[model samples]
Target: MQRKKIAVIGIGSFGKLFVQYLFEDGHEVIAIDKDPVIIDSIKDSVTIAVALDATDEHALISQGIADVDYAVIALADDFETSIICAESLKKCGVKNIYARYQTPLQMKVLELLGIKDLFNPEERAARSMAETFSFSGMRSSFLLSDDYSVVEVTVPKRYINKTIAEADLRHKYNINVITIKRPITNKESKRASDSKGEKILGIPHGNTLLREDDVVVLFGSQSDITRFLES
Candidate 1:
């Protein structure tokens, strides 16, 4: 993969983690924050750390923000500042821009400014955690729309030895399995004994029966998932 340059504005907890992940993934990162202390804390971790107000378009451009492949604004406390930074980044010709907003009104303002991706980390985390309580065996779920969700659920022991056709998953639960995560041997192994080693021995095949420990990734309506779980 081609290494990409990324610029992150507001070195708050969220922004700091995001930049760190980008850098760890082999991307060049430019960290910007109004607080000099915050920039200094992450100076060694990032390619460059700048202490400048992201709301100031000229100052951001001067700090090489315009040359980045992607820009992220994660100023949670100041919505206006986040919007200003987003707009400034857009005007600077940054191709990919991401911003965080707290409320619906703030989201609307960001949308009006032509910001395509707006995230609310708190809300997202809450929603994800809520799914575990609502559905038994659910590890995570994503709301695609008001009526639809993509969910991950562990196949119960009762469902073992049932074929896709026999289970009638679509007709009974209105859920579609998109993919199965079958574990493969690690390619980095050097020894033949290591290659032959039974590391958590199991085979995942489409025609093979589902097991108690197998995780199923399904996509369907929330109502369908609820009803399926109830049955």
Candidate 2:
């Protein structure tokens, strides 16, 4: 991904994590919040942490907020503050503004403010909890046991179109591929994903070709698999 300068307004729990992840992805993140203590807590994790009122348009512009490529308003608990921060961002000419909303009405209001990106943390958290309680085919996505795990993910971009042996995932990342599934063209199907052509390429050999659309089942130490996907 191309690195860009981004600003995160609100150094609460939600914004703190958002800044951390974006910074980890090699982006220059500017952390903004009104609380000096909150800003100090996250200062080391970001490129810069500013203790300023994000609602003030002048204060934001003084920090060169207009030059930022994107800004996220993560003041979920304080909806009023969130709206004001968004207005400041808009006036500063930020092209991308991602806001957090706790309810449908809040989402609508943010939409009216010209924010195309809005998220509901409570709704997402509820959905995630429900999924965790149910039996999912993709449950192998997590730890099957303490020591090992099974994961199903699409072939990495660097590994697409390469033979299994060529990728050398087992040698480099210590993860072994257990199965592969690829869609076969069906003229009557509306989309390739709905073709009902799921076939388990059981016991894949070194010569097996990895396609762009292939989903592979892998088994290995969770840490190793994570390294492989991140690599």
- The lDDT of each candidate is 0.80, 0.83
RMSD of candidate 1 to the truth, in angstroms, is: 5.2
**Cα distance off (Å), candidate 1, residue 123:** 0.6
lDDT of 1 at 230: 75
| TM-score to native of every candidate shown | 0.77, 0.62
CA deviation > 4 Å runs, candidate 1: 142-150, 164-205, 219-231
RMSD of each: 5.2, 15.6
State which candidate has the highest lDDT.
2
lDDT of 1: 0.80
Model 1 lDDT at residue 78: 88
